[model samples]
Target chain A: MSHTLVEINNLSRFYGTLQAVKDVSFTIRQGEVLGFLGPNGAGKTTTMQIISGNLAPSGGSVTIANHDLLEDPRAAKNQIGYLPESPPLYRELTVNEYLDYCAALNNVPRAKRLSARENTKERCGLHDAGKRLIGNLSKGFQQRVGIAQAIIHLPPVVILDEPTVGLDPIQIREIRALIRELGRDHGVILSTHILPEVQTTCDRVQIINKGELVLNESIEGLEHHMKSASLTVAFHQSPDLQFLENLPGVKSVHPEKDGRLRVFHETEQNPTDAILRMAVNKNWGLYEIRPGRLSLEQIFVELTSDAALENAEALATTTTTDSGL
Target chain B: MILTIGIREFKSLFLSPLAWSILAVVQVILGFLFLARLEVFQLYQPQLMAMDGAPGLTEIVLPDLLGNAAVILLLVVPLMTMRLVSEERRNRTLALLFSAPLSMTEIVLGKYLGIILFLLVLLLMIALMPLSLLAGASLDLGLMASGFFGLALLLAGFAAVGLFMSTLTQYTTVAAISTFGALLLFWILDWSGQGTAGGNWLAYLSLFNHYKPFLEGIFNSADAAYHVLLIITFLVLSIRRLDADRLGG
Candidate 1:
């Protein structure tokens, strides 16, 4: 449980004067599926590029299975299988030829290259499209080939950048299932802006906004910690807002449609018992009391919006300094 | 790793119609030029035989035909080499190379050798035209070998330049035109530098000036070295360009 496969320390990347990634640090353990969520242009691709040895970082270091990326790129890269955002493929070659080339490029031994190619093709569901030209394949199959090539050598660490973009809903579901399967054997880092993707496929989630890591937690932790502790109750007659707000352990109360009120409380405290006692004493005619679960979309919106507001405030202060205000 | 990339590149080249079209076009043009040179040589055969210091078939006909072939190669090599890197970049397939464990040198050299192999096939086809005269006439094998050797080096240099230009942009057409433009600069600089003091060095930089010795049946080591140096310089520049892309972006 404690074996770390990838350790990224204080990674930074600057494009001219604009900082793309700033001092980002994280570690991924073996057999852990880490969902890297970020808004557009939030340095997700840049960070993935640096870890895969495609781009150089402006600062910091990355180690893969104890191999330093900058000092020994070949050994470090050999441990990583990367699928970039666009699915880098040679359109002229057939699926089999392309995978064979990829296996060779990743330095699979000559004797095992054929078996490795066949196994990867089977894993990515490309067994039927072996002889088909890559350009002629549908977008979904092409994306599969992209994944097939990445895992041709059976690398220990697999990095996929926006693997499900432009995929049909069904295809997205299938790919998500495939990613989940991959997670069982290899440490996987998947980047996406889709909230449900992380919920369904990832064991842990890390969200980046404005080039900064704003949220990092297990899926269970995100559901339990960031979720507001609340109960939705319906009454035969509406309760006074001040009466419910002043209830023991009740921090705030929001009235909903159909004579219902949502009562909030601290994470460690449940106000339902106190609300029930108060309702009976006042003859509030309460009919139902049910705990509410925060939807993943709500959590995503709240976290990203909060990060955006902080970024805006930081930008304003920098602009003020530049203007000599 | 280099052979793997080279084999893939070579196979992919034949997989497209553009490579076949180029091969057909080169063959037709070279055949017509060879026939024209042969006719001219036959017409002048009697007068040349009667005159002192008259040039033979190898000296008179082969050089003219080969010079024309060299000019045609200037056009054909760029078209062949333009897509080597530029198309990969345009199609966004270069990212595959970046993430792989292979070094930049391996990729560059592998692609270069792949194009060189294609050009070798083209050279073999052209050489058969000159070698066919062996049955009827006594030909200078030495002169023909030197000419073929020079053309091979010259084409290798052209491919190097094309490969380098391809790395500068994602547009294949732009790569093709720039490679043609760069070769033209090297070709014309020799002619333009005629009889000038400071311009003498410019002639040395020209591809034709180094090739002139081989065309004249003189195997000058200095001239051979020139072509080798030119090929090495452009290939090194290509490797450096790829490295910058990996490091900077």
Candidate 2:
């Protein structure tokens, strides 16, 4: 349990004068599936890039298996297998040829290349597609090939940047399954804006907003952390606020202008069974009820939009400061 | 591992339909030029190979052959280099190469060696021309070999330039055209001064100037050193550019 697979301390990256990632630190333990959650251009990719050694950090250090990344990137890097946003692929080569090349570049040893390629192919479900050219494959098969190449060397840590991007629903499920299986044995850090992806697949979730880590917790604890829980309820004539507020679970009832009421409760309360019983007792003609779970999308917008609003205000204040002088 | 990368790049070239078309085009051009050079010799043989002012085969035929080969290599090298880094950038495949365990030096050297190995195969197809000369007449194989060696050096330097330029953009057409233009400028810089004026310094800077001594069968170390220096300079610059991308931050 104490095995720190990845230790990041105050890491940051700056592109010229602009800061891309800033003051982010986290430790991932062995066998943990860490879901890196962020919206577009929120430094999730930049952080992942730095951790994977494709981009260097402007500040701090990342240690993989106790090896410092800055001091010994080769040794640190050898412990990592990264699948970036667009799977880096050789379009002209067959899958077997590409994986064999990946194995060699990854230092898998000459004699073991075949076995390594087979292992990655089997794990990534690319065994049948091994002989096909990557460019000729459909987007789904191409994604599988990308994952196959990343894990060819069997590194302890696998970093995937939006592994499910541009895939159909079936492809998304297949890739998520692949990710889950990979996380079982390898410490996997994946970034995606797909919130349900985080809920269903990840063991831990780290949400970065506007270059700063806004939320870092396990999926199990995420629901508990929110101050409010949304519960959907249906009643005859759309039950009034006093009825919901009086319930033991509910904190407030913010009635929507659309005649439907959105009842918010304390995070710890389930409110489903209780709200149902209350509705029946009152004979308000209850129609529906559900406990609120923040879809990954809503959470991302809430976090980033909030941050952006704050940033806008800060910009205004600075502008005023300059103009007043 | 370096050889492995080289082999992968070499194989990638073969996978394309255009590579075959380019090969056929180059062969046709070379074959046509060979016939033209032979015809010119036949027409001017009386004055050129006179008993009183006889032009040795080495002096006339070998220089002419090497000059034509120099032009062919220039056109061919750009085609090979077009995808080296630019395509990787375009397809976002550079991330894979960068994240791999190999160093920048290994990747760069591997690609150069791959292109060189491919050029050698093309050289083999033309091997018969010199070999036929050896069987039919008394010829200096060493002198002819020097010409091949010079061709290889020029290719090495130009390939490095092409590879470095490839990293500047993601468009293969831009990379190819830029490399061709850069090499054309080098070729012109070498001869423009001797024909006109005000370009002697440019000629000294031209890559072709470094190559000419070897073509003349001089076996000069300075020429070899110049080629080596240019290759190293460009390669180092490319590596440093990637270094900035990955770590200079």
Best by DockQ: 1
Q: Is the docking of candidate 2 incorrect, acceptable, medium or high quality?
A: medium
Off by over 4 Å in 2: A226-299, A308-325, B39-53, B191-200, B247-249
List model 1 lDDT by residue over B92-187, tens digit each. 898898889988999999999899889998999999888888878889999999999999989999999999999999999999999999998998
Predicted structure with the largest TM-score when compared to the true one: 1
- TM-score (C-alpha, index-matched) for candidate 2: 0.87
**DockQ score for model 1:** 0.81
lDDT string, candidate 2, B49-163, tens digits = 5577576665667767778888887988888888888888888998898888778788788877787777777776565565566665677778788888888788888888888
lDDT of 2 by residue, A263-308 (tens): 8877677677777787788778877666656765666678778867
Candidate 1 Cα deviation (angstroms), residue B52 = 3.8
lDDT for each candidate structure: 0.90, 0.82
Candidate 2 collision pairs: A195-A296
A-chain TM-score per prediction?
0.91, 0.84
Error of 1 at B7 (Å): 1.5
Cα lDDT for residue A314, model 1?
100
